[model samples]
Target: MTFLETLLDPFQYQFFIKGLVAALLAGGLCGLIGVFITLRGMSYIGHGLSHAIFGGYAAAPLLGIPIVLGAGLWGLASALAINAVTRRHRIGADAAIGVVTTASFALGVALLTKFGNKGPAFDSLLFGSINGVSIGDLLLLGGVFLGTIAIFTVLYRQLLFSTFDPEVAKVSGVNVGLMDTILMVVLSMSILATLSIIGVTLVAATLVIPPVVARMLTDSFGRMLWIATALGTAAGAVGMYLSYQLEIPSGTTIVLVNAAVFLVVLLLKGAKGLGRTAGLDDHTDASATGLVTASAPTRA
Candidate 1:
């Protein structure tokens, strides 16, 4: 077969097309939301929420609820509970995530052991496969992707303020708590939408890798967002094609592609790039001022 024929072969299958679209949507969505996630130092939240939602996935059938609805609600509740615990108890967010998510995941395991894989397919949910994606899953992923774009566009200033300097944002009447809650909600929704395509185990890698690579490439937050989104979109499309050609798990292929990109960027940029990106947390407020634009309070 010619090169073009090779590229076009996968298009013959409707399933491949659906899976590609789903992968593209899920990857880009994770990239967009992941900026705020990493900036706020809550990188673990994606992993945590994914595990927590698994509990709901297991319990939904027993409760006679649809898996999507039950798992979504459970993920949202877990996000809120983590937020509440961190704020009210004066403990570390890491500790709160560990305690809550592990317990929820343990519940999922117990349920699976006792009841069986009564929710979705066990291997698919854990490792991911494009063959299992349905029309409903595509619609859900597309809807969530569009919703995320709208949220980020509308709340740009507030999100930037709260992410970099929550105390300052609150003092400037930006409603830091509300912003955090909004992020948590979006995050839960993102994880729930992506679980099937990316799998619970690898979802966090999709969320973290693109943004981290973008951060290494740029100091400006605006540029990072654009770069990360582009990288993530490309990774998804390319990874999906590669997975089909190689006959590997789609989720594993996507994550491996991301990791490969990260290594390539690291090698090209060297230690200086890594060190500079590492220090962003310290200078994020001052360095990222240009991101929030004129709408941001001058006081901030």
Candidate 2:
């Protein structure tokens, strides 16, 4: 077969089409949210929340609940719990994340051990199954993507202010707490929606890698958002095609693609320069146009 014929072979399968669209939506969504996550130093939240939501994934079927609603609610509650724990206690955000997510993941493992795997295939949930993605999954992904864009549009300034300087944002009457909650809720939605395609094990890579690469490429927050989104969307589509060609796990392949991009960006930017750019540094332009120059405050 010629190169074009070989590449076009997968299009004959409906599952491939669904999976590809799901991946594209997931990648772009993660990229958009990842900017906030990395900027606020909440990178671990993506990792932690994905694990925490696994408990819900394991439980929803047993309890006769819809996977989307059940697991999504569980993820949201866990996120809120982490936020509350951090605020009300002396424990740091990292510590709270470790505690909450580990316990939740443990619950998942325990349930699986006691009751056996139910709902979906055991391996597919952990490692992802592109062929398993259904029409419903695609709809959920699209909905979450649009919802995230709407939220970001309506609260752009508020989120930006709270992200860089929560204290100042609060003093300026930005309702920093509400902004935090909004972000957590949207993040929960994003993770829950993308869980099926990226799987629990590899989702965090999609969230972190794209934004980090974007940061290395640009100093402007607005540009970072666009660059990250574009990279993620491209990674998703390209990774899907590559996974089909290579006969590998889709989620793993997608993550490897992101990692490869990260490496290339690191090499191009140079180690010293990447270090300088990737680290949270003060920008010179702190304007309403989404160019933030202030050093972001540590979130707990």
Candidate 3:
């Protein structure tokens, strides 16, 4: 069917609409938070948090509580825990993430096994099956996305300053520590957004891959957010479709597609950089900018 035909298709259901809304909201939030994650060089931290939350997910089904809520709470706690340990010691953030997430998730598995042997259901949380999403899940996802956006908007200048130049932000009284804590919280929420919807294994990719691809396409952070969001939305939808039509796993297929997109971007960017040195595509990038102009955000 054509684009118009598809829109008019009666096969369109509320579930599909909800899924799309969830994906868009999740994608935008991830793209925004990912800028900080990518900039801070903490992709592994994102991975650790997503995995650590599995313990909560395992407990949720047995307790009959909100799975996302359970996971988000634990994820946030993990984030704060990482921040605390990394701050008071020589252990870098990455090392802290490695230690905490793996241990917590392992403990979660052991505890879950002891509870009622409900391990397979817990596996679904890790693998993700959007086919099972409900209205409640959509609402929860939306709430997290909006709350994160509002918090970031309120601290826009301070966060940006702290991210780019923490010492200067501290000297200028920007509350750098608070911003760091908030950013980590947002990052945890981003993982929660995708944990059950896209599964834990792919959650980090949904946050990192699109942003990494978006980076090569533009230099401006603003533009990068837009491009990454677009890529994320596309990846989610197309990946789901391929999974359905091909009868493959939806979450894994989408993640693989997103990874492929990232590989392509890396190759293109790498070739360009190599060409620049080899004088193949040797030329100045007119797109480079010293600051954000009104037109500068077009790519984002």
Clashes of each: 0, 1, 2
In model 1, what lDDT does residue 202 have? 92
Model 3 clashing-pair count: 2
> Cα deviation in Å at residue 23, candidate 2?
0.5
Q: What digit string (tens of lDDT, one per residue) describes model 2 on residues 1-300?
A: 999998799999888999899999999999999988888888899999999999998899889899788889899999999998988899998999999999999999899999988877777778777878998999999999999999998898889888887777777677888899999999999999888888889999999989889888876788888999999998998888787888787888899999999999889889764764445533223342244324333334
lDDT of 3 by residue, 207-251 (tens): 777877776777665676678778887888776655555655556
lDDT at position 127, candidate 1 = 69
TM-score of each: 0.95, 0.93, 0.82
Q: After superposition, how far is residue 145 of candidate 1 from its true place, in Å?
A: 1.0
**RMSD to native for every prediction?**
1.8, 3.6, 6.1
The regions of model 3 sitting more than 4 angstroms off are 1-17, 61-65, 117-120, 273-300
Pairs clashing within candidate 3: 223-300, 226-300
